[model samples]
Target: MPRLAQPAGSEDAQDPVALLGNLVKASILRYVRSHPGSTIRPICDALALVSTTVQPRLNELEAAGLVTSDPPWAEGTDRRGIVVRYSVNDEAVTDLYLRLGMALGEF
Candidate 1:
């Protein structure tokens, strides 16, 4: 992995229509990848994001096949807990990161 540069808002927002979507997706993917085996709580904490703010992003990433929720596990009788730990679906996200870096340059 190359030393990934921090994304600057100005850099990411450049050509907003064509690149912003991928920039946001790449940001989320990098977040998920860095926090492997992490639940939304940690993600929120690390990014200073609210649950409401993070949930939709998580849903978007999951829907895009870049993340998967852990299987439900028994908590007690007649109860179960679902924990979602996100991981980067390596190939898709890494490729996006590479492309975005090449196209957008660094922050």
Candidate 2:
């Protein structure tokens, strides 16, 4: 696998290849793209994964700005233990891929 050489701490977001290369991450991405407002449980059910797997991926995606979540607290739900909904940040994904293409040249 080809990779771009970069300085330390330069990876502000996820590596595009790493994100797409993993089966679980790719599936989560596709699912959120199709079902924009899906939460953890639904995503787990649809993908047949457990929360331990799904949650961290979602967190990574969120941290990388690939995915956005509207938590219940932010919406004034006042409900305890309400799971947040996940959605693809289309603009961010576009930016990520654009950078990836530039990095990998012929990618």
Candidate 3:
């Protein structure tokens, strides 16, 4: 298994790469990567998952430093409130690829 670097002082200190092994997490990452600035509601609609389910996974990805979200005070906002748009961390994705290659002896 590949190890993903965790941010300092992260409460959920588990390996992020290991976390990506989960199908839901992987799908969430893929969706965010493609969508770039998508918010939770659309992700739920696209993935057919409820907010309660997707929100926690998004939180995990953010905590793991694999994804980033614009501040709630940013320009975009829904009727509910500030819509936090998420995007994948390109550096982290690159690191994940490198680590996976190394673990598979493909380096």
Candidate 4:
């Protein structure tokens, strides 16, 4: 058996199942991926989820480094924001996917 190559986000292990297994989290990620720089309301409207459900999970994802709320930190992103925008951390997502592939012995 091979060990995980690198950790994803804040977790000690690079476990994609733990990160993306939940339907809500998965959908949220997909939304953020396609709609980079989306605000909470858009996510809620698109997913048909409530603010309570989206906000906390977004916070969690941001904290985990799987998502980023800092638009200014990224290039070509809108800096003007009364409402914080969300985007998927592409590097982190790639790392997680690679980790998942490794775990499945596809790599």
Candidate 5:
């Protein structure tokens, strides 16, 4: 079997399943799943988290392919800034669900 690549300085790298074990990350994922196409400001307001605190978690989720976002730099004037909308990747969510279920012997 091939070894999975690990994010530098990430403790969850050894066990991918540990990604879902984080309360903040889990909450962020759930919020993103529930509120697809939400922007950073709304997410921060809804979750009562600061942008600095939530940005890294969003980056991690995006890096792991669990979430996606609009291009940060687009040609349109309306789309030119730090604002990026986010949405959960349904396929990735389902895969995670199945893996978690199987690990828990629920499947």
Candidate 6:
């Protein structure tokens, strides 16, 4: 297995790459869970990000098993575009988020 770099003060020797990957995944996961059946465009809008940036992050999160896309479908407009819906693996991502929040006094 490939090793990820550990985050600062991560005494567990967890790979940092994987940790950062999880953070990105968590962001997507949180957003998806909060807003299911949403498209990439709206997701980008909610995050204040551009499609270019959001799409790649979505793809990466999908590869990381944190998100899944829905089938291509048409919305109100006649134009055809993929309505990417996302679902998060709650157990993993939520636990991490909770821990981070507790650590940061946000919980």
C-alpha local distance difference test of each model: 0.61, 0.79, 0.77, 0.80, 0.77, 0.60
Q: Of the candidates shown, which would achieve the greatest lDDT relative to the real structure? A: 4
Tens digits of per-residue lDDT for model 6 on 1-107?
53855457654323223544645445656688888777877777777778787776776665555565665322343424544566665665555556555655576
The better-scoring model by lDDT among 1 and 5 is 5
Where is model 5 more than 4 Å wrong at Cα? 1-16, 72-80
Better of 1 and 3 by TM-score: 3
lDDT of 5 by residue, 1-107 (tens): 54867556544233447656588888888899999999988888988999898987887788788889886322333644656889999899788777776655578
Clashing pairs in 5: none
For all candidates, the clash counts are 0, 0, 0, 0, 0, 6
Q: How far in Å is the alpha carbon of 74 misplaced in model 3?
A: 15
For residues 6-102, write the lDDT of model 2, one tens digit per residue. 6564464347876665899889999999999997889999999999998878877877778998862233346348768899999988887887776
Report RMSD for candidate 4. 7.5
RMSD, one per candidate, in order: 10.6, 5.7, 7.5, 7.5, 6.8, 7.3
| Total colliding residue pairs, candidate 5 | 0
Clashing pairs in 6: 4-15, 4-16, 5-15, 5-16, 5-17, 6-16
Task: For candidate 2, report its TM-score.
Answer: 0.71
lDDT of 1 at 67: 66
Model 1 residue 67 CA deviation in Å: 2.2
For model 1, the stretches where C-alpha displacement exceeds 4 angstroms are 1-26, 72-81, 98-107
- lDDT of predicted model 6: 0.60
Candidate 1 residue-wise lDDT, 22-72, digit = tens: 444456667878777788788878777687877767766666556665643
Worst 10 residues of 1 by lDDT: 71-80
Candidate 3 lDDT score relative to the true structure: 0.77
